[model samples]
Target: MNDTGRQSRHLGIHIDRTVGEVYAYASDPANLPAWAHGLGGSMERVGDRWVAESSPMGRIEVAFVPRNELGVLDHHVTLPSGETVHNPVRVIADGAGSEVVFTVRRQPGTSDADFERDASAVAADLARLKEVLEFD
Candidate 1:
């Protein structure tokens, strides 16, 4: 059994937009910085994948999965000593509105402090998304 502690936060909102419209925007990695606060760079498409370079983190791969009821963003960030952290951003639609969940799984032997720090960042990202989608 996988016993690693995984931290997750779920944020839901009922926007005045359709599921398709919301999924379209959330599925595009290139539009991340537009809604993700403190994002300092652009997301580029490499072959069939996407990559983004953040302020504190270097380059990282961005994956997208679009479904009838959900959209998922998966990526890994490298830690100080070459270890990697897996972050999954999930978006689920419930009729008119959608729910965004951020799951950050700490690498084995990694400290809880690191997970907390990343969790804060994920929270900010979700807030930014809410502001943009609700306003537009």
Candidate 2:
């Protein structure tokens, strides 16, 4: 699929942890509620999928890619409206530490203000992730 017309912004934060350490923690859907507030404040594992009932966007479903060594933490978020948004996340080595990057793409009908709000939420979530991994 051609994505040339899609507007995307990559938001990232540096973490005081190794790539493996960050990947292992962030790639686990069970650990999301603690750090990924952008997804929701509460999450539960139901069968093979993680369900978030208190998400800002209402009840949603999240499905992450299978574990891998390449630091790919990509996931799919199924919105309350049944629209699935593809979130591309990655953890990469940065010397002795690592950096986590999340790509926020503006949906077809999303307004500029909403897109920025979404970006801010992702940024906050990344900050929280760093705090959890580095200090907690």
Candidate 3:
């Protein structure tokens, strides 16, 4: 792909829970800290957005889409440098349980190392989500 072209990697995990259960829990920004360690361990609502003050990338503002029945939990994270990253996430039924998928896109000018790092982080986050939803 060209340097300016976007590349995405999908990281996912299977959680031993119903789609409704996973959707309800994952769709809430307040519950992010419990499993989304990549986004920080704490968050607070400020007006219409959720702010994470101690994220690995520093402070960031997160805005999630409105709740719906389609199991879409997409959100945008505004970095400290004012760049907003769109994170596409979904929950889908898999047999009696559910699967969660997170799409990580390589931004323009991102190096191969950084892109792989982002993929690793997403994998860890998905694993954490499964652990939280299944064992917690």
Candidate 4:
């Protein structure tokens, strides 16, 4: 939660593994295209930052702090009216498993319907990730 009343939707699961092992798999940029649906391009390192291109989301920039066990991904998508919506994803490790939180703050004059749609997409992505990591 933040001052803007924009709270993230947090998802969590516990795995029978060490935090480091789970973190390694989750933080690997190369694994994104395998589990993440819309990511089409490879993740490359630009100095200390990571960037990936997606067909649906365009270019996304990510920053990670391994010591703090935090990651942030920032991206934008255009609406039907040509308005851009910002989507931020925050990833953190709680214990054996990790917690993934997604936040979407609507642009000025944007409707809540758009936010709901984006949130559903995020949920789907997370669900896919869980299936890949846990079952596969």
lDDT of each candidate versus the true structure: 0.63, 0.91, 0.91, 0.57
Cα RMSD of all models vs. native, in order, equals 3.5, 2.4, 1.0, 5.1
* Residue 33, candidate 2: alpha-carbon lDDT: 90
Residue pairs with colliding backbones in model 4 are none
- In Å, residue 16's CA in model 4 sits off its true spot by 5.8
What lDDT tens digits, residue by residue, belong to model 4 across residues 86-129? 65655556665666555645444435676567566666777776
The parts of candidate 1 lying over 4 Å away from their true place are: 1-16, 37-39, 66-69, 73-85
lDDT of 3 at 92: 88
CA shift at 2, candidate 2, in angstroms?
A: 15
Predicted candidate 2 versus true structure: per-residue lDDT over 79-106, tens digit per residue: 9999999999999998899999999998
lDDT of 3 by residue, 1-136 (tens): 5764378888888899999999999988999998889889899999989999999999999999999898999999999999999999999889999999898999988888988988998898888888888988
The total number of steric clashes, by the backbone 3 Å criterion, in model 1 comes to 0
Can you tell me which runs of candidate 2 are displaced by over 4 Å? Answer: 1-5
lDDT minimum window of 10 residues, candidate 1: 6-15
Cα deviation at 13, candidate 1, in Å, is 5.4
Structural similarity to truth (TM-score) of each candidate: 0.71, 0.93, 0.96, 0.60
Instruction: Predict model 1's lDDT versus the native.
Output: 0.63
> How many clashes (backbone atoms < 3 Å, residues ≥3 apart in a chain or on different chains) does model 3 have?
0
